[model samples]
Target chain A: MKYLRLVLRSFLRSKRRTVLTILSITVSVALIAILQSILATLNAFANNPDASNRIVVRHKVSITNLLPTRYADWLRQQPEVESVMGLQWFQGVYIDRSNFFPNFASEAEFVNTVFKEEIVEYSDAQFREFLRDRNGALVGKNLADKYGWKLGDVVSLKSELFPITVRLTIRCIFRSKRPADELALHFNYKLLEEGVSYMKGRVGTFFVRVHRADDVPKLIERIDRHFHDAVEPTYSETENAFQLEFLKMMGNYSAIIQMITGAVLVAILIVTANTMAMAIRERTTEISVLRAIGFRTSQILAMLMGEGILLSVLGGAGGLAIAWLLAGAVRGYVGTFLPYLQNFHIDAGTMSLCFHATLAVGTLSTFIPAYRAARRPIVDGLRSL
Target chain B: MSGEPIIRLRGLAKSYYRESLEIPVLQGIDLEIPAGGYYALMGPSGSGKTTLLNLIAGIDRPTGGELEVCGHTLNGLDDDELAAWRSTYVGFIFQNYNLVPVLTAFENVELPLLLTPMSRRARREKVEEALAHVGLTEWMEHYPRQLSGGQEQRVAVARAIVGDPELLVADEPTGALDHKNAEEIMALMEGLNRDLGKTIVMVTHDPKAAHHARHQIHLEKGVLDRTIEVNR
Candidate 1:
């Protein structure tokens, strides 16, 4: 603390260079924070604790392959199964191709029961009204709020996968634990079946809710075994695993993000190291004078290291602030295309990582140069003047 | 000047090594300066006068022989120990003033005191007193760049005396100053020696500056040539 003023004065000696170094670190840290937050959001979906008791049943070939809707009946008959629902990705565009969201055709009777953790809240009367009306649709609160949709508003969607346009009336607006889940719209599967002839008894997936969390593994094994000899073999996994499968389709995104973050860190380290090296080199004479005046080599090293760390921490803080302010806009933009990132925000873990990363950069970058400056022969330094 | 000498050197030697070759700067020179004595080392360029001063100040160690300054055997102490000893017993003033450009005059003067266990208020009072002694009290807040060459050297003098070290070693303290500034600096050193009884050793090429000292030691080819008791 006694040397803080000296360090601060030396740091501000070159205002332009210091500010530039800080800005470089700030921009790099912000990029790392945003990228890491994206990875965190995806990981959260694949590790959700709420998905423990639920299982998903899909065709053995691929998720794109449809299964017989009668699979839900067999799933429901199992002693471990509490409820089941058939869900299909509609791949529909509302108004035009620009407005995109996950719209699904689902069996309304067991949706709230099978996905109780996701469908956190909804009106019972509104759900009954949705069941009574053939063209009724259930919109998530975020989706409804985004489009300024209300009860009785008619929404028309043209399907890209099938030759049909289904006009739906908004009946129930439900809330979910995750903002990503709340950016979807669901309607009765019967509507799609009535619109297209071949889609009558097929669904993309069947969601099964087990009576207990421990029953999920056994039930998944039994269901896959029961359909092994049938015309369409089944693959069953817990809901968390199903979400991870979707993420897996993106191909090792975690490694890619980590690589990019690493590259950015290395680049910033080089930049910061170069700046500190130059600063120390410029003060060689001053350093020697201090040494000659009875200041210890360790004291000189401490003051220089303090300056470097202070610069990096300042940049790290600025970057975190930038990431925080832009989080909402990032969520809104990315939610349009990637459903998993709709709730994307910089969590405490990511902030801590960035802060620690900057400290490491500061220490590693300044160590060699500061040590060299401190250990240089005092006579050589004095002679340089 | 009674009692034992403040500085004792017995055949002190220093050399520079360039890879496989050796270049000797000081060789088998012995000298001593009594306590409270104002002495000047006068020689031509590269005569090893500054090297001798540096050795006496404990900033550099001799490659051979014994060196004792301020009653401490400098030859036996390591680099860190030498630094600590210098802080307690020796102060330095360089040819270029060597004030840290980033620090104000006050900060530069306070640099030596920061290494001590002195309180902030005590250090401040000492620094102010030193600067006032140098007639630079009003320029305390100004940076080195803001001060004149003479004023900067005065600040350097303040810094050298602020810690109240027993010995002051100056290597051409007026080498960068004009005639008027050099005279002012010489007068200040003379006053420090006569009034406060500081043991002063200065290396200089200026005859007028050397005349300010009570004794003059001349060096040639890295060895002491003669000693003269000044009539001043």
Candidate 2:
């Protein structure tokens, strides 16, 4: 307690320097927290994708090479396959030059049934209405609001591959807080079949939702066997494996994430080491006095290390509080850019690592300076003017 | 220097090493300081009076000496034990009244007593008594920078006696004081010595300050020569 007053006085005496150091610590930690939060949310969303129980069957040559339309009928006959649906990448742009979102050509009859987890809203009546009209469409709430398209509003879209401008009547709009299907627009696939040029009797891919999540592997093998020698050879995969392949094409997201993590740690080390060095430099006389008053060299060392731990914990708590308040909102805002991320945590494990790194900087940074202080002769220290 | 000794040193030797050469300061000297006596040691700068005082105060280890204080030979005591001995037995008074700048006079005086097991109430009472003894009862809460030179020295005297140590050692106790303030500080020490029967050993280069002592010893080249003994 006696030594604590001395330490407090010393720190208080250099308020500006201490405040600056703390500010640096807080900023670095907060930035690190935000980065980790974004990465965490993306990892969670991608790893636990809503469509993992489903499989995608795209044309073996390219997505533009549609599978024979008869493949869906054949797949539905398989005992393990419950339902099959079609999806085509629409590759379209809105009437206005600035607005951008993904548009998908999908089967109105089997789309919601095969991708049930992605259904934000719909019923049998609306599904029949959309399938009956070649011009009918359902858009995401964000896309609908972006272009002010209400139900029955004619929306014009430019198709890069088709010669004619595509027009659609909005049949419904669905908004979801979940990222997976929240930003997509579903167009009538039957309408696309007549307007767009394609190989005859073909669809973009097959989506198969299994009866049991565990039977997916056996079901995949059975489904693949049926298409092994077909004219349009198929590439079938569970939804998660498809996502993994997409992420793999991204050149090493995991390594990039690790690099970000390491950069944050190194930034923290720089600030902490700077703060500790500054703290030790200013307390030479006070440290000497404490040693002379019968506190051992080890005790003096403890005194300094204690002060640093307190400072870091202060900065650490400040940073984590900022993260806790802002992470949820930030995740929601960045939903489209990286859809997998869900939450950020300053958990015990990260905190424990922070503590150890902080402790190392606090304790070890004191050695060269505190020891310079401790090694001075008492009479020499007392004689200082 | 004494008929009945409270501190004894036999064949004392101290050396300062410059590289490999041992530059001798004190070579083969014997001295004694008696209990309940006021003595002054006078010498020029570098005459080894401060070194001898430090040796006696157990603040510095002697290279070779059979140094016994209050009948315990200090030859074999470790640093912890030596510090314990100094806290319980030897009191120090610095020339500049080395009160810690951050502490009040009362708190500064309470420092040596912290080494003891005394409870707060007893310690407070002892500190009050010590302040009253030095005639600065009103200055207890003042910082050293706030007090006059004489008052700061008196606080130093109070701090020394607060531990109830048997030996009081002062190095150049009145060196920095003006004559009138120096006299007041000397008179305070004399009162503590003569009235309370506390053994006080003061080193000074000023004869007017030494005049307050009952005995005086002159140290030249680490050898003490007994001078005039006066009974006041």
Tens digits of per-residue lDDT, candidate 1, A1-385, equal 7889999999999999999999999999999999999999999989998889989999999988889998888888999889999998898899887788899899988888887988899999999998888899988999999899999999999999889999999999999988988988889999999998888999899988888999887888899999999999999999899999889999999999999999999999999999999999988999998999899999999999999999999999999999998888898887778888898999999999999999999999999999999999998888886
Per-residue alpha-carbon lDDT of model 2 for A263-285, expressed as tens digits? Answer: 87677666766766766655555
List iRMS (one decimal) for every candidate.
0.8, 3.4
Query: List-wise, what DockQ does each model earn?
Result: 0.82, 0.22
Per-model root-mean-square deviation over C-alphas = 1.2, 5.1
Query: Candidate 1's error at B195, in angstroms?
Result: 0.7
Go through the candidates in order and give each one's C-alpha lDDT.
0.92, 0.72
DockQ of 1: 0.82
* CAPRI level of candidate 2: incorrect
What interface-residue Cα RMSD does candidate 1 give after superposition? 0.8
Give per-residue lDDT, candidate 1, residue A368.
99
Tell me how many clashing residue pairs each candidate has: 0, 5
Model 2, residue A2: distance off in Å is 5.5
Kindly provide the TM-score of model 1 when superposed on the true structure, using C-alpha atoms. 0.98
Model 2 Cα shift for residue A241 (angstroms): 4.9
Name model 2 segments beyond 4 Å from true: A1-3, A49-195, A199-282, A325-329, A332-356, A371-377, A383-385, B1-30, B34-59, B66-232
